[model samples]
Target: MSSATAPHRVSDAPSLVVSLENSPEAAAAARDVAGDFLKGLGPPPGRDASDAVVLIVSELVTNAVRHSRTRACTLSLAAGPGTVTVSVADASPRPPCERNPDVRGAGGGFGWPMVRRLAVSTSVETSSQGKTVSAVVAREGGPSV
Candidate 1:
């Protein structure tokens, strides 16, 4: 008898990693991935945190597209016991800076601050070829509120 192909059964919550091109499309794609990741979490303990995650994804991806020379980016989502970690890697050695208000007043930078405000933990690491900006958000308790 021929063996029947078993139907694929996926878990309700699963980690996702997506590589993106350094273009405008990457920002939108990252946001979509964030939304899907939160939905896969089966119900965010707090809705605001979920929204923040999406916005953070967009801002990070935009920065990657704008600054990176390699024109390649990656978005990764991992759910832990109480937090979800979102990491964006791009081919850029120059790290992001939190420009002062006077500099921002020139109307150029603010993304980093927004990211810092939304995430429980934010970090940037530089590698020989590029950098990775990672943010961890508390999915359970939700943004210290």
Candidate 2:
């Protein structure tokens, strides 16, 4: 289950928020929420950008649920002038690590790499209680460099 709330928006739109307890369905739920949110943006983010946002949402939420040694996490999305920022805050201090992809087996470690390549900007903020991972992706109609 997820709960959502937005910070007060003065000149801009409110951020999209979703709270998810660690569960197998968390990733899918996040993707759906992201897709829906993108549709509300004035001009569509374009096929590639829209797809990237959903994929990023899935990868990040999945990581929080599968790796974070915590019971819940929050997924927040904010749309800026030309970019969409997706952030997942989990109750864990450890940051995400990348490992070589498992081609033949199921020791899956591909999520982090895909996320890095898709987001033009990425950040991780760690605290005593947890960490928040954020990825910023540019919209197609906006600046690419």
Candidate 3:
């Protein structure tokens, strides 16, 4: 887990960026990072919002590692007044697709769909070198769980 949080700038809110190897642990690391980042905020996002962010981060990072040929990926998180933006960049230019979920719960495609459901907005950008999948989640004012 190689990560860095951007220095607080007078004009912008704080942000976090992490570089992760294409391994099983990357998703967990990303979740922890997101949790910590949210907690550090002056007024942290609600429990629902925080959980949604972690779940979305895990899904995006997992997709990048499992589907792409890339050896590593980068995760970026930025929080504003009422929303947080999560972005994962990988070396593959192919866009993500939601696959049919497996009923047995052994292992099937479900990440993409869950992300869409939790996020207020989601987008993907692709170039010759790679692609970045981004999702924005609205922060609620409820108490943390």
Error of 1 at 117 (Å): 1.0
lDDT of 1 by residue, 29-128 (tens): 6787678778877656468778878888888888888877665787877788677888888878898888764563665578888889888989999999
- For model 2, residues 15-123, the per-residue Cα lDDT tens digits are 6777777788788778777887899898768788889989999999899988997888888899877789999999999999989889987888898888888888889
User: Candidates' lDDT values, in order?
Assistant: 0.76, 0.82, 0.82
lDDT over C-alpha atoms for residue 62 of model 2: 91
For candidate 2, the clash count comes to 0
Q: What is the lDDT of candidate 1?
A: 0.76
TM-score of 1: 0.82
lDDT of 2: 0.82
Show pairs that collide, candidate 2. none
